[model samples]
Structures are given as C-alpha cells and as structure tokens.
Target: MNKTVFITGASSGIGRAAAQLFLQQGWNVAATMRTPDKEKVLTGANLKLLQLDVTDSNSIEAAIREAIVHFGQIDVLINNAGYGSVGIFEAFTPEQIHRQFDTNVFGLMNVTAQMLPHFRKNKRGTIINVASIGGKVTFPLYSLYHSSKWAVEGFSESLHYELRNLGIKVKIVEPGVIKTDFYSRSQDMINDENLEEYQHYLKTVFNNTQSSGTNGESPEVVAKAIYKAATDGSKKLRYPVGSPANWLLPLRKLLPESWFFAIVRSNVEKGL
Candidate 1:
C-alpha cells in the first residue's frame, strides 16, 4: 500500500504544492485548511480535504481523526499551517504577540501532539515542521514572526532526539523566500498611526522585505524539499530550501554576530 501524508494549510503555497507533488508521486494526501470548502485546486481519488484550524484543539482532533479514517494510516505529518506578523515590536499588542505564537508555535505543537499517539502506535512516521530561514536569521519588521519560528526550530531540534529511537522522525524544512501568499494574504502587518517616529524606518524595511518575496523562488522548490525529507529515510533533521537559504544559512553560522547583523541591516535597513 502507498504511504499517506497529512498536510495543514493546504489551501495554497508550499502546502498545496506538496500535496499535489505527493499525490503525483503515488501517495495518499490529506490536504487540510481552515476553509476547505473554498479550495478548488486539490482533487483526486487519493486526496482528502479536511477543515483544520490549527489554533483550535477540537478542529485539530477532528481533522486528524477524519484523515486516519479516510487514509487508514498517516505516514507523514506536515505542520505547515502558519502565518507571519510583521512591524515594529513596540507597536505589537499583547493579542498580536499571542496570535503569532498561538498559530506559528502552539498550533504546530498541538497538531504534532495529536499525531504522536498514532505515530507511536505505528512505530514508524515522519513529522515535518515547516519553519523558515528566519528561524535562524533575522530581518527587520518581523520580530514577532521570527520569535515564533525560532521556537519551532528549537522545538523540532529537541523533539528529534527523543523520537529518533522510536522509529519516528522529526524534520524541519526551512525555506528562504518562497513566492507565496505569505507576502500578502497570509501576512499580518502591525500598524500604529500614532507611532509615527518609525514610519520611515518601517517603510524602508517593509519595502526591502517585499522585494525579496518578489524575487523569491516558487513554492514548488520547498515542496520538493519536503518530499525529500519525507521519503529520504534518513535521520537528517534540517532541510533548508531555496537558493538564498543555501548560502544565507551557512553564512549566518560562519559570520560573527556583529558582522551578520550589519549585513542584515545593510540589506533591509538600507535607506534608514
């Protein structure tokens, strides 16, 4: 029997791309999103669309249960349901901070928790967490987003140690700048009109950030990386995708703290 992969945030971007690729590669796909009814892209005999709001435990439980019933077993779980919140850190309200963590960090944890028992029972499974190069490197106007992804990176790395001996693998897929709805539809920009002091700085950094997305690789690139992590059958943990990530990640590690920060400032805070 073919293996099955359950993906969250499958309505678009990397999640949708991965779902399509896995199906084409002869695997069953449980494509999940907050509004499954709005999705018209993914459809086939081996595809099951599920409604899942990662922040909601009931929704997560229901989606997992439905996926298992439909596919019999889930060989891989992709925690791809997340969004980015950007802007001045000082302007971020308590709710925004909580929202960022709730979706990007807590939500991912919740889904993984729901799947652990099932994965444990099977004794063989892969958990792929969709993180970002930002998890390791930082950029302007994305403090909240960076913190959430950093949590994911740390969480996935630590979880891998415990799961390795259990025949369950934990992998983190870190993409650089993928051309996706994350730049627009999936991004939350924190704006405060009263905080005019950082207006020029914010505009400069935001424009620079947007330009990176404009030149970003297609979501398919990250999807291919995700596929490799799922099927490679190795204990490898981090898979950084996209051209920028290839160089950026290593550079961040090699360069000193001040040097790396300077480089980031030069790029994103050029005009400021």
Candidate 2:
C-alpha cells in the first residue's frame, strides 16, 4: 500500500517541494497551508490540498481528520510552518515575540500533540520537524528565530526517546540558508523607532544574511532530505541538509563555543 504524508506550510518552499516529491514517489500527499484555495499547483489524484494554520488547534485537528478521512492513514507528518523574525532583540515587542514563539515553537508542539494519538494507534509513523542551521548555531540579528528553532531542536531530541518506544520516529531537518520566500515574504522584520542604537550593525548583518541567501541551496534539496528522513526506516534523529548546514553543524560540534561564536561573527557580522 502507498503511504501518506501530511505537510504543513505547503503553499510554497520546502513544504510544497516535499508534497510534489512525495506524490511523484507514489505517496498520497496532504498539502496543507493557511490558504489552500490560492494554491494553484500540486493537484492530482493523490494530492489533497488542505487549509491548516498550526497556530489554531481547531484548524490543525480539522485538517488532520480530513486528511485521514481522505487518505485512510497518515504515515508521516511534516512540521514546516514557521517564519523568521529578525532584528535587534531589544527592539522586539511583546506581541512580536509571542507571535514568533506561538507560530514556530508552540504551534509545532500543537500539531505534534494532535498527531500523537493517531500515530500511537497506528504503531508506526514519522514526524519531521523543519528546523534551521540557526537552531544549532546562532547568528547576530536572529535572536527570536534562533530561540524558536533551538526549542524545536531540543524538543525533537527529547521527544525521540518517548516516541521511539511506541514505534514512531521523530526527526529534525536542519537546513542551511535555502533559496526560498523565507528570505523574502516569509520573513518578518522587527522595528522600534526608539531603538535606533543598533541600526548600523543591524543593517550590516541583514545585508550579509541576504547576500548569503542568494547563494544557498534550493528548497527542493531540503525536500529530498526530508523525504529521506521519512523513508530511511532508521532511528536517525537529525538530518542536516544543504551546504552550510552540513558543513557548519560539524564545526559547531567540534569547535569550542567561543570559537564557533567568533567564526560566525567574522563571517556574518564583522566588516558587514
């Protein structure tokens, strides 16, 4: 029997790419997003476009139930609905901080919680959380974004122990800077007129980040890594995809904390 994969944030980028790739590989795909009606692509006999906002438990539950009704079972769950809120940490308003964590960290937990009962009953499933290289290594102006992803990394690692005993696997995809709308429309900027102290430093770091993004891997590369994680049939917890992630994850592990910070500062912050 063909397996089924339910993906969040399927409107574009890694989620959309994963949906298409899974469908091509003969799996049923539940391509979900906030606005499914606006999605013009990834339609076929095996694909079910769904409206799901991870921040809304009702929407998450409804989408998962509808997907189960349509596909009979969900073999994999991909948590890919998140955005980067970048800027000076002190400039971030309470609302912005809450929104960032609500969508990235808490929202991911909500979806995972909703899927657990179904997955436990089935005795076999996979949860692939799309984190970033920033999850493991921090950058200058992405304090909120990195916090959320770090939370995800820690959550996935600990959750793996509990879920594995139930025959379910939890995986984290740490992608490097992928060439996606995330660098454009999907990113939120923090602004505070009173907090103009860090303007020059912020601009330099932001410019450097944007320039690096132009040379990063495509979303499809991360999609392929996600697919491998889902179907690899092993207990692997972390799969770092893309160039910088693959290279830098090891560097972070091997190097001292201060050294790693220095390297990041030099490459991304200094002379920027």
Which numbered prediction scores highest in TM-score against the true structure? 1
Query: Where's the lowest-lDDT run of ten residues in candidate 2?
Result: 190-199
How would you encode candidate 1's per-residue C-alpha lDDT over 95-187 as one tens digit per residue? 989999999999999999999999999998999999999899999889999999999999999999999999999999999999999999889
Q: Candidate 1, residue 57: CA error in Å?
A: 0.5
Instruction: Please count the clashing residue pairs in each candidate, in the order shown.
Output: 0, 0
TM-score of each: 0.98, 0.98
Tell me the lDDT of model 2 at 182. Answer: 90
Residue 266 shift from truth in candidate 1, angstroms:
1.0
**Model 2: CA > 4 A from native:** none
Candidate 2 on 1-272: residue-level lDDT in tens?
Answer: 78999999999989999999999999999999999989898888999999999889999999999999999999999999999999898888899999999999999999999999999999989999999998998898899999999999999999999988899999999999899989889898876767778888888898998899888789999999999999888888999999898789999999999998889889888675
